[model samples]
Target chain A: MSNEHTAGPHSVGRRLIDLVPHIVLIVGVLIFAFPIYVTLIGSTWDAATIGRGSLPMTPGGEAWTNYSQAWSESHGERASYTPVRLMLMNSLIMALSIAVGKIAISILSAYAVAFFRFPLRMVFFWMIFITLMLPVEVRIIPTYKVVADLGMIDSYAGLAIPLIASATATLLFRQFFLTIPDELVEAAKIDGAGPLRFFFDILLPLSKTNIAALFVILFIYGWNQYLWPLLVTNSADMETIVIGITKMIGTGEAANDWNLIMATTVMAMLPPVAVVVFMQRWFIKGLVDSEK
Target chain B: MQRRVIFDNKLLPYLLLAPQVAVTLIFFIWPASQAVWQSVHIQDAFGLRSEFVWFENFTAILSDPNYVGTLRITAVFSLSVAVLSMAVALLLAALADAKIKGAAVYKTLLIWPYALAPAVAAVLWMFIFNPEIGSLGRLLNAMGYNWDYRLNGDQALTMVILAASWKQVSYNFIFFLAGLQAIPRSVLEAANIDGAGPVRRFWTITFPLLSPTTFFLLVVDMVYAFCETFGTIHALTHGGPGKATETLIFRVYQDGVVNNDLGASSAQSVLLMVILIVLTTIQFRFVERKVHYS
Candidate 1:
């Protein structure tokens, strides 16, 4: 432990030595960025050209053709039902519903855990935590069976209802609520504010950073949902964007055109990436907080 | 406080918890239990009906060569992805902590890959590995190595691992970076004063301190790599070229969904759940002790 406290350094040499690792990390970043670049570049090339891997640095003049072809086949497989548009709409609805329901419910649950003295508080918290350990894949089939039995398969509710309680979200809000200054809640109570009023006006407003982070994280989690949606939706009508992309790639039945797949992949990747890029620190912070 | 007593009573708590509890129990717990019940029995090849063959499905799965291979591949895949992703993430996180100019931009670029859904990421990677038109294959062909991803099981597995690792690295990096930032500057300066080299500082000081974060990420990423690589398996390889990429989750999917052998699928799922629980419990037991919050 004492050895870890070294502060002596030759400034320039130290900086230069440190620069070596940073430079290497930049190379790592490039490796990380390669797929994004390849997908974007592939999207611009025609299926024929991109398939041949003959794309030039600049466009060889086939962007419009591929884009239009992609759009046409993609507009709808059935009656104005392109995988792209339909799945995009599905994604928005599913993601929003999950986010809204999850955040709202988790907030309430977290409040109970944080503020109220319920019987077996630790046990309840641990129960929620243990549920987080339950793998989604393990239950996906039985869940499918349940949904099928209920006649909810291929419906929006099928996708949204099953995942209504996000254990991770509840955990996050619970963690956040734990940190709120107790004095404020007391002050609200003294001012004759009801618990609900204090929760809304006093507690929530003070937890903006946490709520913002939670919103972004939950939204991304919802938007990126694939397995449940894939298992739930069969008709082209019910597919989410990610699931649509999955089906559009046409698993063993039809051979896929790599260029078109890449193009669609690029289009599908942008929205979540946009969200992540904007709120990166908060997202990372959220992960760190949860890790604790 | 008396006004709060009514609000805080049993009724309100249950109401607040009702929606989530009901959904989880119905969708997750019920289905999982159903699968467990089904697995003990046997089903027809086409899953039309089940014969009550006690422990037969479990016996068959245990004895099956394919099941063993799936478990091995899954273990290797999950371990490699978790360890490699954590290493890469920590390295990048350390660099970003060096306070280089444009550190924010660098961090943004590094973590962007994680935001892509697994299906999309797998697809994007497939383009790079595509023998016909993928950029990597093209670049490699231009450079003169054969580099066929679909040509062999090893190559195919490698491609999936890389893709999985790529998605995970950003997620690991986010935690690693945050952990790094949380380490106070004063301590790091003190380490420098004691003339510790960077590597020494990292291993002896920084890493031990990041143990809690590392432990947490270890469990999270392991669970993710084990259970959630199904989409990656589906879109990219489809467990093809003789089922090299058939992870436990994907295998369970094939048995339960496409094959519709509800009994056999359920058995596989139960086994998978058992494996997850055991591994997770062991991990928490071993790692939790070493994790120092302060």
Candidate 2:
């Protein structure tokens, strides 16, 4: 189909009709961008300016002071005073551990289920698959009990380990591995290559795209985790940036440092948003494909 | 769909599956079973006594007015979020799907909000609507409207819903856009050639074709609203202004963690599991049918 067929002979009225999509889309984009824009501008201003309502639309001159204060020390008179730097580091560790751990174990299990015929193979697969119904929130209490029993509470393992038993990633990898041709396995067999070798040499290389895609999704999932970290992490040192920012707000009091909190919010959102924006294609692929 | 030629390994497969299976069994299976067990068994307030109470906890939860209120709130909240987000997303997606300049830029700009945490999104909105320091809130007050979410239950519910829906629009937009793109252009072109206007063609040809994606998103969005909006509610209103915004999930947290009411919380959790299982089964069945059709 040529563009002219859709475009038609453009009368003035027809041209105005054609502009509707752009107009609506621009409005939608502005609505979506406005919050972040406000946050960005708010981060640059001091608390006193923000507190005296009618927030300034323009960036202020306190960007350096606000960011430095937020990054290093706790400014608000909150109970817990963990620095944003420590919280960001904690979030990074948790996110990385979850993404890497989920991928590693899921791929292994997927490889095993795809390549080898063993006793109770379907049983094992179903065991993992059944977990799709059990989110951390549903079984929060019992899971916390189990973690406490294992003495993993307030630890990094507690933060990430309970989250890594992912049915979706395993299912995603398993689905991908099933599409690999049997001829490759046969060729490897004829060459006296063992299962592990074939996996290392063939399967791992083939799964690179899926791995990277899943990593982006899982990393964001890990970073954005709120309830689990809020429950498990007792010490301020173990706080993720997401929970940390909320703590800094401290009941929405006027005494709260709005500028510093906004700065921390920016820092908190930077990594995951950057990942999604930079790896847009893979992130979309991973999300859509994994859900399917 | 098992592979034709497979490895004949026995011990290695178990070894390979150990970590995932171990985690699932220890964390997921065991805790889930414990939830079931705890729902049936009641515990005293202190750390000492316990009693086997069959269906008592379940009955208590079902009979509680607050639980029922939470159930209603969850229904309203999830439906509003799903409808609001999906509606906005569909509009934006339809506009972007048109042959327009800078569609890609609009999509990139629109989709980044999906990366923001629900808590962070709540905080952003809180900053915007905080009545004290919030620009919009101040504007609303200046317009002679009482716009304090912190003091009013209805306002609190509205604020949380807006924040939650704002964060979720990007996700639904991506899916809706993908669904729109997957329609064969020839079919649309034929519709255009048949003298059908754009609006008519959209209603007749486009929407029916998009139903599968629409159905899929509805279920996904409902699940997201039910399970994932905890942070938004927590940060924005703390399920407060007198239990107005407390969804089932938030109520579970309150009963479980804060009040130390383990039995009631476990019962609630089991109910949520049933809800999730039903949703998951529906989703999987629809997906399988979709796969067969494709």
Candidate 3:
């Protein structure tokens, strides 16, 4: 860690070298932040201002007007008109249900895989593991057929349930459960604690952090779901914010209301971005842990 | 990896496993098997009847020039997005890994883009590059450059690629930054004391040490480019001025959902599944091989 040799003659050069990293990082931050910044700024301006091709570098006085228009008004000339308010609620329901449902099922399944010695245990584990290879995009049509067959279309069940079965969350929970000391289980056995009691009393309490981390990750994953919701939910009321935003701009680009569209885009991004930014530590942990 | 002391209750274990098993079967296994079944059987145009035609659907899709073109387009698009995003991310990560002031602030700003949905990312860039109203698009036009993606095939592909890469850079950065920080400071310091310049040290020492992370990210980034960019393409170009931007995955959607060609779409889905499984297997094998190396 010593930099003693740079004290005398080369201090200027060392200072410049130090500045280089900062320069690069600052540029990087700006490059990544530029489009988001532009959108935020554009969302504040009037439709005419944006339509005239004048990019606002600063916030305009029409911020509320733009946001309220996006939120409350029926958007587009399309027949399937749903307010952004309905979409946000639908998105919330979908994201929350998927996150909660995934954690519930995944934790139980992980408990079985980690703590139990049932027959065909390896087979069950591999069955769940194989789901990781087949994303929603691959078998989307047939999956749509399955959901349709169950008459789940246009409901929260259709929007959330199919997505709730996550291989990553189960794997994460399994890894976490495996790290629990054997003494805990032994102690529970000695106390005549049943499996459910031990799980609820001890295991759940110990997994608070893991649960939070997975919640943040899965909430965002569910929120950002576009194709599946777009496929499954045809009714306007069932539209998610992300899907709704795309629908808003799904028409000819020349006729799009850039201001309202940008405003909706901003709204669509807020929850997920907030989850990631506010819960940065857990989000990072969840990402790294899930990938591992 | 099972525990020595385990729960022996027969009914309880099955009860614990039931929900996930049911879901995996109904949603995943069932759908995947249907895709395979449909791939071998083509329904008539009117949807009145269907007959088994083993390998006919696959052979038809394999021989179709448009399908072949889509495969090429996917290769180009995936490779471009991966390389562009990975290069930008590696550069940023290397710089940010230095012990610099406000590094945390910079990192926070950079990583939030990862949270943006692909559709949102596409719209944000689409607005910036919209020919009529986009600031950058207008500026480019004013500069006398013909930069309309709406009419031009190559321009649309380039726009989608940029949007996709922009969204991916943040994710790659997080992993690369973590990898860079995990390298031993002593090894780097030793190189410094030996009169090696930063660039030389980076090439000779830092990069090689970071290969595992780099390799891991390569597979993840490629997979991301392959499947997840659907929103990006769907929102922005919708596969285009003339199908120039339609990836294999997009064709699967277009053919199935839009065109209602169930047989061809199922065949495409099966092909995509094979590609992903092969990619995943390679990734796992590489990971296993790396473990033995260290």
TM-score of each: 0.89, 0.98, 0.96
Q: What docking grade does candidate 1 earn?
A: medium
Tens digits of per-residue lDDT, candidate 1, A93-198, equal 8988887788787788787777777676666666666666575777778888899999998899988888776777787777677666666667766788876787
Q: Rank the candidates by lDDT, best first.
A: 2, 3, 1
lDDT of 3 by residue, B1-294 (tens): 888888888888889999999999999999999999999998887878889999999999999999999999999999999889999999998888887788898889889988888988999887789888888999999999998998999999999999999999999999999889989999999998898988999999999999998888888988998899999999998898889999998999999999989999999999999999988888888877865875
- Candidate 2, residue A76: the lDDT equals 50
Cα RMSD for candidate 2?
1.9
TM-score of chain B of 3: 0.97
| Chain A TM-scores in order | 0.83, 0.96, 0.94
Kindly report which residue stretches of model 2 are placed more than 4 angstroms away from their true locations once superposed. Answer: A1-8, A76-80
Q: What is the lDDT for B125 in model 1? A: 82
Candidate 2, TM-score of its B chain:
0.98
lDDT of each: 0.75, 0.92, 0.89
DockQ by candidate, in order: 0.51, 0.86, 0.81
Could you give the TM-score of chain B for each candidate, in order?
0.89, 0.98, 0.97
Best-fitting candidate, scored by TM-score: 2
